[model samples]
Each structure stands twice: as C-alpha cells, then as structure tokens.
Target chain A: MPDVIQIKAFGMIAEAIGSDSLEIENPGTSLALKKQLEAQFPGLKSMKFSLAVDKKMIQEDTDISQGKEIALLPPFSGG
Target chain B: MDRFERQVILPGFGPEGQGKLKQSSVLVIGAGGLGCPVLLYLAAAGVGKIGVVDGDVVSLSNLNRQVLFGEKDLRKNKAETAVRYFQDKYSDIQWEIFPEFITVENAQELILGYDLVIDGSDNFPTRYLVNDACVLMEKPLVFGAIYQHEGQVSVFNHGPNSCNYRDLYPQMPSAKEIPNCSETGVLGVLPGIIGNLMALESIKVLSGFGKPLKNKVLFFNSLTSQTYEVEISANSDSKSSIPETWKDFEQMDYELACEGIKQLSWNEAMKLMGHDVAFVDVREPGELPPLECTGLMKVPFSTLSSQLDRFEDAEEVLFFCQSGIRSQKAAQQLQQVYPDKKIFSIRGGINALKS
Candidate 1:
C-alpha cells in the first residue's frame, strides 16, 4: 500500500467540495496523485492551484513519500 | 459580560482584548473606505503593531467614504494620515506606515513578518498578490470587498483550516467588464460596514474566540439587509499545484488574465467603425448606457464568446465595456480564435465614447 498524503482547500473551492481535507493514497509520482485528486474533486477542472509538497511548491514530477503533507492552494484574494 | 470581554480581562488584556491586540501585528493595504474602518477599529481596539500601506494621497472624492482623512488631508499620503490618526488616538500602540502601494516585488518580504493581513484594496491585482504572499508565509489574511451595497468577508490561508482567495474566483474578469468605484460610484457607508466585518474577522482569528469565517465566505447585502454564508471545501485537484516559486506568480499576470485583449482609444476605434468594422458591447443588455454611435452592435460580454460567429463577415471587430478593461479581454480572446481578423478594444470604453 502506498503512503497517504493529506491535502486541504479553502474559500470557493471549499464551498464546492464541502470539506477542507482529503486523504489520498500516494501514487508514487505527483502526476498520478494529481489524477486521483481530480477524480475525487471534480470542481477543480476549471480552477488553478499551486501544488506544494510538505509546504514547498514542487514543479517537477517528484516522488511522494509516505505521510507527506500536500496542499492544493487556490489563487489568493486578499489585498 | 460578553465572551470577548472575558478574554479581554485576562492578564494581558485587563478585561478588554487590548492586550492581545497590543501584541498583535496587522498589515492593512489600501487606505480607502474599507481601509478607513479597518484602521480605525483596529487602532481603537488597541492592536499593538499596525502597518498602513497605500500609494495614493487623499482626494476630495475619497473624503466621502474614507473617514480617516478630511479636507486637510487632501494631497497628503493616506498611509501617513492613518498613522497619525492611530498615533493620536492611541499613543500606546506602535504604528508604522508604508506610503507606497504594495507591489508583487515587495509583497512577500513585507507580508512575511506580519501576524495578520487586512485587505482593503480596490483592485484584483493587488488582492491576488496579497493572497499568494500570505499563503507562502503561512500568515492569516482577513479578506473584505464591497461592490455597491454588497460586501464579502473571509479568513484566508491561516492554517490547515484556511482557504486561499483564488478558490472563490478562479480567474480575473477584465477590468473593463467591472465598473470600479471611480466610474460606478458607491455609498459612503458601505465600506464602513465591510471594513468593520474585516476587523471582526481579524479579531476572531487573533484571539481564536468565535468561529472564524475560515474556509467560509460570508456575504452581506446592505440593500436588503441580508447576510448569507457559503461553505467552501478544499479542492482536491488543487493538491500538488502550489506555485513553486516567485516566477510562477509572475506567470499568472492578472492584468492580462482578467483583461487579456488589446484596446484602442475611442478615436482609434471610430476610424474602423464602417461596414468592415464590427462593434460589440460585451455588456449586459440593461448595462448598456446611452451612447451615440453608428455601426455598433450590442452584445454583453458574458455571451461574446458564443456570439462570435455573428460577426464572421466583418474584417475587423471593436469591443467596449464601461471602462475598457473587459473589452480588451474580449479582443484578446477574439484575436486568439481569429488570428487574421483584427480585434481592438475602445480604451476607456463607452464612458469615453460619451465623453
């Protein structure tokens, strides 16, 4: 079994999903995990989120470890 | 006594939230109407450190809504006035003022040290920049915005429970599509009501007292005196999508994102106003203000994408909105789809046309 990654969202996206956190089985690569998340959260098809692994944004297809913290950050609205 | 009062009475606050407030550091962007109330209340509440950031000086028009200044403050920096006001009202609290507007270049550094961020800005670019910086810094942000009689408030990027602003608006709408207060006008008291809500949310977040609007959006309609709350959930697709660097932030140019198209002045658009040139309003039907122009077609911006086929015969197209921001975006989109046909936006929009 792959390790699980914890993710969270807020504001409009939260309103759409109706919850703040999701636990997904790490699928080895960020791309696979992204696909799994999209299937679970359909509202993100049109939205943009900065993907961060353990609070640091990752651009490349990095390997995911067990129990790593993942956050899907939506565009900010505050001034 | 109120629960808030009980927390105030504790050792640091002495029966008021003053002490907790005194220890708290808050950065307020924009000294306009919304900033006015946020500044006044937070200062009065005895917040310890307050930073006021704004680039513009006081204008006669702002006097109507910005309570922080008066006739004497005209042409004077807004951040300076706010600092002076807080200093005079509560000498005990430490206040700092940044007279320059917060920009993408300095936002992250300036916002990193603050405990909380209060957004009172009027534009989308600044708002998005602030949200991204706060999320990067792991700082709590109290968000508020007012359009006519409606206002919205939310706590963003506080912690595991926090949400970012982009979750609410995935993309920026062209500036021309939306009428800013400068063109549309607003009630003087609207910002006060909204600013107070921002203060309330900030206080809630700082003291960890009541249920903060974290991950939730609360909308207030002053016209009908109704309040609505919407639940916002975490977007799973957003996972693994955090912007990796500052360069990524620059990639999303909100000015271009919201208003992607290019535009020309009214005079420039008039040159092409013949049979070969098509004019599309890109505004809602009722939103079309009275304007005297020939060879113009009215199509609200929302439906412009779908109605593009109607103008297939025209060699060129011109788009206009109240301010020209939306029209530019429309033109940009049209240019992408029809690379051969020229699409132009009327700068300053219909308001300019009428002028």
Candidate 2:
C-alpha cells in the first residue's frame, strides 16, 4: 500500500486547493511535497506558505514520515 | 475598591501582575478590526499607557468591526478617534495618538517609545515593516491577522531567544498574489476573536503569568472552532535577513520589496496612461462608478484571456480593478503571455482614489 499523508491547509491555501484537508501520497521530503502540491494547484505556485511537519515549522528539506499530519500555513494580511 | 479588583484578586496574577500591567506600555499599529479589541481590552486591563497609530480615517465600512467608532466618528482619523473614545469612556490609562501609519521613517521613533507592540496592520508591507522595526528595537510584539474565517496570532521577539515573524514565513508573499479584507471579505467576529487573543498575549507577556505565544504561532479556524499551533525555531537565515541597523532599515522599501509584479501608485499609473501604454480596467463589467480614464480598455478579469489581441500594439499595460486585487491577477496572467511587455498593476485601484 502506498503510504499516505494528511495535509491541512489554512486561509487562501485552502481556497486554492479546493479543500481544507486532503490525503496525498507521501512525497518523502518537505521540498518534494511543496513541488507536488504546486504542480497540482497552479494557484499555489506564486503564493508563499510555511510547511509544518508534525506541528513543527520546517526550515529545511526534512523527511516526512508516513501518516503524519502536515499543515500549510500562509501569512494573513487582513486585520 | 479598586477598578482592577477582579483581575487583581485572581491567584498567580495578583497585585504583582496588576502592577506589571499598570507599568507596561503598548503601541498598537492600526486602529481597524484587530486593533479595536486589543486596545479596548488593554485599556480595560489597566495597561499604563497605550499609543494608537493609524493614518486611515474611519469610513462607513469600518463600523462593522472597528467598534470604537460611530457614525459621528466617520471621516475622523482612526487613531485620533480611538484615542478620544478611550479617553472618554475607558480607564485612566494615558493614551497617545500618532494619527499616522507606521512608515519606515517614523517606525523606529514610534516603536522606541513603547515596551511592546501589537501589529494589526492590514497589508504585508506594514506587517513586515512593523515586525522588522520591533525586532530591531528589541521589543515584544503581539501579532494578529485574519482572512475570512481563519485567523493567526503570534508573539514575536519576546526575548533574546524567541523567534520573530521572519522565522515563520521567511519571505514576504508577493502583494500581487494576496488580496485585502475588502477584496476577500471577512467575518466581523474573526478579528474580534484574534484580537482578544492578542490582548490576552500582551497581558501574559507583560505580567509573566501564563505562557505567552513566544516561539509559537497559533492558527485558529472559526469555521471549525478549532485551534492548532506550529512550534517556531529561530531560522538563522531569516534572523540574519533583518537589517542590522537603523540606517539600513530606513533605506528599506517594503512596498517594492513585496511586489513580484511591478506596482504603480495612482499618480505613477496616470503618467503612463497615454501613448503606447494601455490601461486595462480588470474589474467586472458593472462593478461600479466606472473608471473614466483616457483610452482605457474595459476588460474584466474573467474575460482577460480572450482579450489579449486587444493589447497587441501596446508597449506597456497597466491593470487596475476596484481595489487592485483582480487587476494584479490580470497583470500576472498577461505577463506570462507577453514576457517582453511592461505589465504593472495600479496599487489600491479606483477605491483608493475614491478614498
């Protein structure tokens, strides 16, 4: 069985991806996951968001474990 | 019977906590949605002094979330009105008003006077400007922002070891890709929830009672009524990206820095309107109060793709919508097709000119 990771998107990221949460095949690394998501959602290509793996913001390309919950958090401009 | 008797009586947050709050001053940068509740609670909680800085005047549309203003307050400077309201109805906390936005020129001077800052600014430029200024000045910052149903709250620069906003999102998202509150729309209560949390964090940071959101960014979804947080570690690259000195900071141009697609002010856009320059209004066909400009093309963003042939001869194209959100999208889309043409989006669009 292909390992799957759960992704939670917030704000405009959620709107662009069409859903707040989704399941995708584990992309192994944080950078790969970002590329995969961007390839699927053209709207996200220009947008900037922080990827959090297991509730920790990832600064570098870190391996993502199977079944982990990853969050896509974007900075909000509105007050 | 003291006015702070209720809060002062709580265990672990007694006389000492009250005293701490009574001595700390906070500068709130924006008197809009989030600032209203933050200022209201901070003043009620007996913060020693509060400074309200906002260059915007209270328009009729601001009445929904900016509860500090009334019909009589419309057209008055937001900072001035907020200060006046607090002075008339709230505690004896000393109130200071800037009646201006926190620009780089005044950011250092403004932040230097306060111990902490609460950023409720609406745009990325101001947010980044405020964050860098607070980090440079070495002040604790309570940050809150809302977009539609979701909100984010964080405490940055709380200590030497704490992470700031730069560590969370290392790069500022291009202004072209993002829309403002007016463009996307927001629930009236979203800012209320986020702003109250910011106020709570301010009190926590000031009194040293509960754990502040230091090194943590809280994400709240009002739709699900759930809260989640991401642990922040100081990214060395992000930390180093901040300008080292006041001279370097003053030279920073936040607006241009955040712009991926070149953005022109109304005045700048007007200067290039004629000749081979094409001015495109990308708002909907019937958006409102038509833009009466010389040689302007009415190309709604929805139909921009099929109208590319219309701009075949133009050397430069400028896009503008009601508030410049859709125009930015249009400019980005067109820039991809015509890589050699100079495509720009007019900042703030027609609504900005109206205001």
Clashes of each: 29, 0
Report every candidate's CA lDDT.
0.71, 0.88
Q: Write the per-residue lDDT of candidate 1 for residues B303-331, one digit (tens) a residue.
A: 88898788789898888887565777778
Instruction: For each candidate, report its DockQ versus the true two-chain complex.
Output: 0.07, 0.77
Which of the numbered candidates is closest to the native, going by highest TM-score? 2
Give the Å error, residue B213, model 2.
0.7
Model 2 lDDT tens row, B220-303: 999999999999877778978789899999988786578657777787887887789998888887777787766888998988
Q: Which portions of model 1 show Cα errors greater than 4 Å? A: A1-79, B1-17, B237-242, B250-252, B261-355
> Model 1 — TM-score against the truth?
0.60
Pairs with backbone N, CA or C atoms under 3 Å apart (clashes), candidate 2: none
